[model samples]
Every structure is written in C-alpha cells, then in structure tokens.
Target: MSSSLHSPWQRHVPQIQRKHQHWLTDTGSLTQKLKNHCEQFVVQRVRQNRAFLNLSETKSLCLPLGRRILQRQVLLICDDSPVVFAHTVTALERAGRDWPFFNQLGNRALGLTLFANPLVCRSDFEYTRICAQDALYQIAQTALHTHHFKVNLPRHIWARRCLFQHVRHQNSRMMVTELMLPEIYQLEKTSKAR
Candidate 1:
C-alpha cells in the first residue's frame, strides 16, 4: 500500500493528546526518560548497514533514491517490553564526519549521544499514525518478532521524526524516526493508576 493511504505527519504538537503530549513533546533525552520509568532499559540493534533512503526520506534529506546512506534500526526495550522502534539514516559521506561515534554505537542508545552533544540541533518534530500496511510498521513488527516479542499487531502505531544537524557542519544531517508501541501507552496507563 502507498504511504498516502496512511496518516501523514503533522508538525502541530497540540494535535496529540495531553497524556501522550508529555512523552511526544519532551525535548529531553528519551533514553533517560525510559530508564527513569522502567527498571530495565536496553537498546536492541536490529540492523546497521548501508542502504538507500526512502522517497520521503530522500526528499527530507535532499538526496536521490540511489544515493547510499547508513541505515540503523533498533528497538528500545523498557522493563523487558519493546516500547519503541527507532530508525536512523545518515548520508554515508557525512556519517563519520558528523557523528564520529556513530559506527561505535553498538547496543548503545543514540539519544544519549545526540542529546548530550552541545552542537547537535534537532528540527521540529513531525508526528504520524502508521497503519499495518506501512513499511515502517512492518519493519517494527519484524524487529519485535525477531526479538521474540509477541506480535499482535495494532491497527495503527503512533510515530514521530525529526532531523538532526551538526551546528558547525552544514552538510551533516541525520534523520531519526521512532514508532511508539502499544506497551508505551500501557505503561502510561499503569503509571497514572499508581
């Protein structure tokens, strides 16, 4: 199915519910937040390899379809529950120069590095609700299944993305997108009941 059939991303933050707003709009490191909320937090690297960016990504990064880029996919598990699927893309030429430690992030949370860096600037967030037919939805589900997580796929998954750029390096850009799993909202509900 085409991406047009799915919900398109919106830049408006107010569109999200107030409860989820805190999680979606927070500018702080997501890794740290997850750690605070869960007894165990782990980053499971699903795949890290060179790949071409999708059409939307290509347009966002101003690159062509055939252009090679470093693609990294990981699942952020909190308290043994898979809560988020994160996908990052960076132009191969700029990967090393912009994010020198990118290649070394083995099972390490990228949010910790990006948020800690004083030179890293993040663009306004864009939110979307992805259906089962979306490529990203399949990627996320596959990652979960690969990790032995029970996959009763949801009708739609909420996600957000933003572009990151090195302040001193104009050519260095990285796109990070995260799909929030059902466990995330379940955690929120449990916390509220406490």
Candidate 2:
C-alpha cells in the first residue's frame, strides 16, 4: 500500500500476476500491441501542460535544476474502455528541438513516434506500483470520471517506464510511464472467453 510515486521502479515485480508482468515487460511498440487487444484502440489525450515533474521523473529525464517540463497524460482506450494510463515528460526547452513531434501528437500514441525514429534509443523498462495517493493513480481516476467510464479501478495499479534518448544528443530525451488499468484485466478476461 505504498502511496508514493517515488517508489523504486524495478526490472520485475515478482508478486504481480504473470499476466500483468507480460504487459509490463513487453519492449515492443505498446500502441501496436494495444491495437490488437480491441476492435478499436484510441489514445485519449487528457492533459498536456508545462509543469515541474516529481523528483523521480526529473532525475530520470535528466532535466536541469527544477526547470519546467512538458507533461502529457493520456488514457489508452480499447473499444471505448480505458485500459492504460500513460504519462510523459520532456524538457520544455529541448522538446521541439529533440522531440519535434511531441507537441503535435494530438490523439496519436507517443509510442508511434518514438518507435519510428532511428535516432532514438530506449533504455530498459522499470516497473512500479502506483497506489491511490500517487499523482499518477489520481490522474487515472480523474480521467475515468471525466470520460464517464463506468469501470471501477483498483486502489493500486502496475506501471512500467523507460527513457527514449536521442542518439545524437544523449541528454535530449523523454521519459514515458504507462500504467495498466484494472479494466485492462477485465478486457483480457472477456477476450479469452470469446
């Protein structure tokens, strides 16, 4: 029941279900994998604003002394049901120069752009459990309410994160965190029953 977002992100969480671990460790394109999970996969953009990221995020992205960064949050919806919550942070100063398409990705998955670039290199995946008090969990709840999704999310969720860095300018990179929402398991169950 750890409520801190600063909880260490590990390579694996042995206590979670094997199914949950499957999704967390998949290094392939998440946007593509999600497309196969439902008839329709959509990226619902929740918020994209300038703000200071939490300490963990700031350090992961290697941002300068508490500088403002671009924070974008989205819910990956499958057949109208939200399945995953995603948060991304890029230094506002270098965003356009480094992550040129980040600001233009309206409802499109950021994974699409990241995976397509040959100049970008991704680091290893790190796993984390997000409890109710964590900002990420709170954002997921708010997204559910705002979108009027009837699904009841759990008090905690499992999320994985990694950094996408520019091969040319190593310091210019973005950190992406994705949380598998509870409804995702429901969808998996229903799909298996079919």
Alpha-carbon runs more than 4 Å astray in model 2: 1-6, 188-194
TM-score of 2: 0.90
Which digits, one per residue and each the tens of the lDDT, describe model 1 over residues 113-190? 999899999998988888888887888898899889996678887888899999999878999998888887666423
What are the lDDT scores of the predictions, listed in order? 0.84, 0.81
Query: Any runs in candidate 1 off by more than 4 Å, and if so which?
Result: 1-5, 14-16, 188-194
Cα lDDT tens digits for candidate 2, 63-159: 6546788989999998888889898988888898988888899999999889999999999999877777787787778888998987666777888
Name the top TM-score candidate.
Answer: 1
> Which ten residues in a row are the worst by lDDT in model 1?
185-194
Clashes of each: 0, 0
- Report the poorest 10 consecutive residues by lDDT, candidate 2: 185-194
Compared with the true structure, the alpha-carbon lDDT of candidate 2 equals 0.81
